[model samples]
Target: MLIMATKLNKKLLKTLSAVLFSAVVFVGCNDFFGDKTDLSFIDLPEFTNRDIAYVPIQPAWDQFVYPTDICIGFDELLYVVDEATQQIIGLDESGREQGRFSVPGVTSVTQDRRFDLLACGTLDTVSASGDPITLACIYRIRLLNQNGQYGIRYARIVNKIIHPFYSRSNVNAQDLTVRFGKVAIMASDIPSQNNRYYVTRQGQGGSSILGPNDAVLIFSNTDQFETPISVSTSSGIFNNFFQKPSGIATYAVPPQIQASQERHFFYSSVDPANELKVQFIEYIETDFGAEFRPVIFPVGDTSRADGFLFEPNKFSKPSAIAVAGDNTRFLFVVDEEKDSLFQFTRDGFEGVLPPPATGRTKLEKASFGGTGNGLTQFNRPSGVGYYRRIVYVADSGNGRILRFRLTLDFN
Candidate 1:
């Protein structure tokens, strides 16, 4: 009877030891339901359609005066042109200021595949009467120093294409009144035309159509004059196609090797008289060399397309435009008059198509804005930029830069 009692005691002791070991293991590991695991995006179906539109990315960059334009360069850096400061400020993806370069009257900027900045600004020259005159100019800024360092502070204006002087040696009365708008750095598979860029010029033209005023003019990679764009429409080759064109964009966006080599671009016009304000032009090779042709869209044909980019009287003042370089190829336009940021699919639809199998048929109207300083609102927003799934807007009247990401892009 004593031995049996001792054996029971030993068994009880062993069981107690095992329980303590288990408790220690649990404590050393995670408590309760183990390490907290975030629910996957799909695990929450309640988010469906509720957060399907663009959501703000908090804490806007609010340090500028009349920020005219913003762009994501080939270097994957953010560049902003501030006309009030007459400077181009460069920043990292985190919005940290990297460097700033001063120009006379910098308004808009675009970077090429070669990483050179092509911007529209003003250059001052002495007239024959010994008076200083500022003419609209295109500047090719090499973001490199003599020591081979890369930075906007080290950037130098290697070349300047002054108005009238770039097109012809002589200047007309209307040339002095001309002002440059935006620059679209073009890309081509051909080596000779790879870095050529297009500049939007505007002027009174002396109330006549004698010159290339209010036109999109092309320049060679070497900064030589190419030709003004003559868009081919259903009405044949139209020389006077652009009216008050202020914004231009190309598909040759950053990360260099991944950029498209297509000679196509999207441009925006602020002209109040035009029915359509935004248009896309493609460089197609024809039997007679090459010509720029406008890509037409079917309007009011819901069965064929939900929306059309060529819809008449759609925009009041589409001041700035951006073409997504990713697989999405989305287009972004910001209207100053309407104070709105509009998004579109590659097919010119008004919004992003609903995700597969959500019991939704129509596209979400992703465009939004008003005349306030809200997260989704803008005050005379003049610039739009896109990279990856993020969109950046230059709220010039508000003196800030706003960023947003579509909720559909959430992981």
Candidate 2:
């Protein structure tokens, strides 16, 4: 009996030891195990016809063959810049094309009529080797209606308006925004001609020094506007830095948190060789100004080369992005290559809500892909804007304007 009791105690001790060992191993391997499975996207039902809003273009402004970027103004008007013709057109609320005006050496337009301001970036110079020159200054314009033909009455030249402070090229300020006496610009440029290493890195997939912007540049204080904060980098990853900075919007939550955390800014990027990486960066208002780095999403997280798993075979080249209202976890993106528009949402922190049920929304059948839309397929679709119930796209290649009004809600 004594020997049997001793044996039982020994068995219990061994079992307890094994359990403790297993617990330790489990704790240590949790992150590894989680990473083992593909967590970039969630396994959800393919999108059906649930969330979609498609509207046709009114025939007037449809004259553009290649449209570059779009802006919304005060009188329920839509303005589109045609880089090809150096012209800008206006569209009325009913989708009817009103008339057109011209801009000298102007390639883009960015403005919100509600704020009574507009801005654009110009390719000031170019090298004989055909490389684009620096974006010297951001031209500001004020929209006015002169007997129905829209006119740019107010203008100013702001020099060296580069945001995130790392972009080598300049912005097409037409991709920027002005609201509540604040000018929020998404300035992008490939690394400038600093050294041969910068050029080679951009060409050979090497590290880009000033390509990725360190922060969204802000020019505030006109009416008590504050200077912008800067973005930082812990990882050295950089290149094609600001290849495409489509849209800029501010997130203001007031009467809530401390004044410092009241506002945030979100911007988007579409990097192809970088694994078709579509990234959203958030800028927090710190003691100085805007602070930013890439925000990690559980889903849609992968190296720049994994390619978009959803459309692996199709060539995915995204261009523009816009956030949804009510501060939802969704964004509208345009793929210039496909000439199709996609709606993506954050499914928790781990998955991207797939494209809407209507599948891919077509802006115009003939000029839907490539750069711009017009009587032709989009030549080089570039910028996008969302407000109230409507969505706007910059049909850069076609020099035309396209608009879509959201008719359905996505739960």
Candidate 3:
């Protein structure tokens, strides 16, 4: 045991060094989030594509030209929004066309807790003083029942702020989500300059160019715009301001845990960017007013102050996101560019941030579908909704709606 050790050969030394380096790299890549467990090796349940329903598009009559969004009503019926046709078509559980309502220049649709369908779009109308103005507004439609007939009535309109100087409203409503009797509308070109809204004049006259502050405008259940929550990228906290806030999904906290939580609402956003990232924000109520606090969830080896997940190469133009109702255990995101749906689970991460990784929250589980027109594929899928363990996808490019069910493994 006291004998002098033999000098190692140069080749052997190099081999040992290479082996150590490889081991370090492997550990660094796999356990970047300071977790001992490897997420790639975690066994999770897979999502199976059960059925696909195509909306009839023909020469005589076209039901859906470019379906952009979808919502699940209180009655469990599916409402699909078509941008090209400017209509929200209702489909039964079996994917049959039940009824359709026209909403001109429609961009997004959602059903409130009262079973009233809320449609967000642009409309041409006169201002309060009778001036011609184009405005972005939300229309609430009530479901009527008479003689076994599915009659729909246009109830009221919640008009967004329109600048008196400009002919059209500066706000460009992208998406809307209703939760806890509150409506959150994602918009761009928010009035910020000296509390005034301005837009750059294109073409021959283009000098008055004023930038806008993108925001999430809050509205009450009575269809009134309350205040605008501006999302700023200037602070070192946020990675960037939302360029194109496409879709939003809200999660309501359960009653049992509501007392202990300062943040009641958990919302996710899908912004179209070069590197698609999913932004998570918690709706916190402060003494001043309601605030949207960005949650910095750990993803891979880094911690993002603005987003929970970041995979630019994998996500190509993510359009929409949906979380399990009341249960934040599962989440789904629709990638329009890749034409696929990504599933995430709250297995390894914490539910809340700041005190990060204290409790199990959610992480990416698996992904399914691809770019195609087949039954098991998607073409530029836009909106996604989860209800009663079933996921409904608005396959915009293919003019259809695809549904899938979650297959959980107790073992």
Candidate 4:
């Protein structure tokens, strides 16, 4: 009985000590907080699926004219291509204009890992007859001067890749129809392939002694013409795979230091003839050599449906595409006809997954847009950019740039 009583007494003492400790902690907390009638506290850090909505950061920079495309440069600066003025407008992430440089006939702008700007535009020159002629050309705008000063104002035309002349010394009349619409820069650990880019050419379509006009042509870091990307599959190789490819994006995005060596790229086509608007081509290396393959998802089930990125007719006039090189690896596509922005997972799902608490097993559909000047609406939004968890859109028809952040990302 004495031993049993001693054990019971120890247990009771431990329970009492625990109760006393908890009471002291609670009282101390109350003492620290009770004196303050009003307290300021940050919202809970945990984000539930109910908080999964992309909200706009209002008061957009509305000073642009027909901004056709936007790129978040390797420098972490925002570059907007205003096609109407044929200028590339530079801005900080906060929407403040930094500087602007004009490129004749520039329709889209891309930045390489070297911080140089590659613009798809036209070059005005006199033909053999001394007649003024405009030809599709890719201009390499060196943002740094001989002194190594860097700024948009310091930008100068250091190199030019004219249509047929880029490949051969001679230029022909048939090459006149070729237009370079977009350029996507690639980063490779291999020195020889570093800073390479792919340019989309459109206007003519043919398989001749010269490659097809409507195709994606690769270029070296020196701006020299490389071979076009040939999409090969189990069946065969396709030289003329792209149809007026409107936008091309590589895994190598901005931030010079963290740029990806990934050669895979996402490309979009606005051509009415292209039944499928957006496509992803992955680079695969084999003993035979390196070959590019297109990622194909079965769209067989009609209901194989809304959330899948490859769903039939999912996009209308997809003007541009951007891929996150960060951990998210999210995909962004802006459509002109639909006037909306779509987000997808790297594996091709429509939206981010919902939290377990949401009582939903599917991803929360977050893609949104419409016509108008409202905060979320975009008019002919031709470009989409991603950086630091923010989405920037070039509201072309609205003559402005708008930004958004997912509520779950807010502090």
What local lDDT does model 2 show for residue 183? 29
- Candidate 2 residues 301-390, lDDT tens each? 442222232333233665555554444444566677777665544321211322344343322111123333333245556666565555
- Per-residue lDDT tens digits of candidate 3, residues 317-399? 67777666545456677888888777654322312221123242322234567788765578898878776666778888888
Candidate 3's displacement at residue 303, Å, is 16
Candidate order by TM-score, decreasing, is: 1, 4, 3, 2
Q: What is the lDDT of residue 346 in candidate 3?
A: 39
In model 4, the runs with Cα more than 4 Å from the true position are: 1-51, 298-305, 356-359
Please report, as a residue range, the 10-residue window in candidate 2 with the lowest summed lDDT.
193-202
Q: What are the per-model numbers of colliding residue pairs?
A: 0, 52, 6, 1
Q: What C-alpha lDDT do the candidate models reach, one value each?
A: 0.82, 0.43, 0.51, 0.82
Q: Which wins on lDDT, candidate 3 or candidate 4?
A: 4
Task: Evaluate model 4: give its lDDT.
Answer: 0.82
TM-score, structure 1 vs. true: 0.85
Clash pairs, model 3 backbone: 32-301, 345-362, 345-363, 346-361, 346-362, 349-361
Model 3 TM-score (2 dp): 0.59
Give residue 225's error in model 3 in angstroms.
1.6
Pairs with backbone N, CA or C atoms under 3 Å apart (clashes), candidate 1: none
For candidate 2, what is the TM-score? Answer: 0.52
Local error of candidate 1 at residue 292 (angstroms): 1.3
Specify the poorest-scoring 10-residue window by lDDT in model 1. 39-48
